[model samples]
Target: MEHIYLLALVGGGLIGLSATLLLYTLGRIAGICGITFSLFMPQITDKKWRITFILGLVSGAFLIHLLTPIAIPAAPTDNIYLLIIAGLLVGFGTQLGNGCTSGHGICGIARKSPRSIIATITFMAIGFITVFVLRHIWGVI
Candidate 1:
């Protein structure tokens, strides 16, 4: 348990450090959703950088999986339709909020952006309510 906590702290610190470094170096916020969404924007002048950045994310994940025999628990079983609906809801929420967890929760909160703070709080509240409704109130899952 202590090891897990230590690993989590290290991982979170690395994420924060990397995000800060990216922001400092690129003069762009380390909001992954924004970076990814920018790919479709007409004014995206640096496509190669975006593509390489995205590729690095994928490659990094693959490298971690290969280097560490991590235990990824099986996803909780749930109704397929409900799962799809939830996914769509989350997508809509991210769009409406102008960012997702990585954007608001990670980088935004770290920088103390008021807008991001509100969005993060809202996102977490919604998540908590949804889980409560599904598991306790409605017994959906």
Candidate 2:
């Protein structure tokens, strides 16, 4: 139980460190959605760094999953169409909000950006409502 807490602490610290480093070195926000969205844009001149950043994210997670005793949680449902719809909804929400949780909740709030703060609040509120609807109201989960 204590090890789980330790793992979470270390993981969170690493995330903060990486976000800080990315901002300091590249003058860019460590927003996963924005990074991924920009990856497909042909006109973006800094594709190399973006590719490297994304690869680092993937490899880092793989390494942690491989090395750690922690078991990654399974998704609630295995329905492919439902999963696809959920993903699309999330992507649309991110676009509408201009950033995802890591951007608005972590980096944006840390930087004290008003828009990010509001967006993060809205994100959390909607997330709570969605979970409630899925689990309690509709019993979907």
Candidate 3:
């Protein structure tokens, strides 16, 4: 648990630093969903930045694996149909929310946006309720 905490701290600091640097240098928000979505849009003129950003994300994770001994979590025990439905629900939620956890929780909240605060709270509460329903109420643990 202590190791997990330390790892999370390091990962979070890296994310925050990367977001700040991107914001300072590019005059843009470092929201991955926004960045990624922009890449697929027909109006995107310069694709290099988006490609590089995604590559950096993948390479950074690869570098972390090279430097650390983190183990991958086991595959979900839930049925594939259920997982697909959950994924679709999450995607819909993300679209409806206008941003994801990292976008709203990290960047938006950091900027002191009231909408982000509410969105983050709702996201977390829903997550907590889902876990409680799964593990306790539904006995799915």
Candidate with the greatest TM-score versus the true structure: 2
Residue ranges of candidate 2 with Cα displaced over 4 Å = none
Ranking according to lDDT, highest score first? 2, 3, 1
lDDT of each: 0.82, 0.89, 0.85
For model 3, what is the alpha-carbon lDDT of residue 7?
Answer: 84
> Relative to the unseen true structure, what is the C-alpha lDDT of residue 109 in candidate 3, on a scale of 0 to 100?
96
How would you encode candidate 1's per-residue C-alpha lDDT over 1-141 as one tens digit per residue? 698899899888878887888888887667777778778888988877778878988887788778898665578667799879877987777777889888899888888999999998988898899889889999987
Across residues 41-92, which tens digit of lDDT does each residue of candidate 3 receive?
Answer: 8998877887899899989988877887876567886688778878898777
- How good is model 2 by TM-score? 0.90
Query: What's model 1's lDDT at 8?
Result: 90
Q: What 10-residue stretch in candidate 1 is worst by lDDT? A: 70-79
Candidate 1 shows a clash count of 0
Q: How would you encode candidate 2's per-residue C-alpha lDDT over 1-141 as one tens digit per residue?
A: 697799889988999999999999999999999888887778877888989999999999988879977677786789788799999988888877879988888899999999999999888998899889989999976
